[model samples]
Target: MKLLLWLLLFVLCWPLALLALLLWPLLWLLSLPFRLIGISVEAVFALLRALLLLPARLLGHRGS
Candidate 1:
């Protein structure tokens, strides 16, 4: 009787545990694209600032 109870508990909980394990990585993978987009946008802004400064400097701007 005790063995049967243990087996039943294990069976019930196993699926939930497995689902958590599978979904964790899947959720991380799904968010990866958003993370990459954020990084790229920051890079683009940095490049734009550098390019804009070059022209301002050429035009004899003291600070910009």
Candidate 2:
């Protein structure tokens, strides 16, 4: 789906499309740290949730 949109852009605006092609890797590199931070944040939230639920789990609470 994203490829189709990029192909359409390539047909309609070659220069912009070419620029996007060139910048793709740089954009991905720039985003890598943000992705890692997001993963860390998600893991922290999951740990908090598990810690919050631990007592209930130990008491044999069933999640449905």
**What are the Cα lDDT values of the candidates?**
0.95, 0.95
Tens digit of lDDT per residue, candidate 1, span 1-64? 9999999999999999999998999999999999999999999999999898988889988874
Q: What is the lDDT of candidate 1?
A: 0.95
Report the alpha-carbon TM-score of model 1 versus the true structure. 0.49
Alpha-carbon RMSD to native, per candidate: 6.8, 6.8
| Cα-lDDT of candidate 2 | 0.95
- Runs in model 1 lying further than 4 Å from the true structure: 1-22, 55-64
Badly placed stretches (over 4 Å) of model 2 are 1-12
Which ten residues in a row are the worst by lDDT in model 2? 9-18
Candidate 2: the clashing residue pairs are none
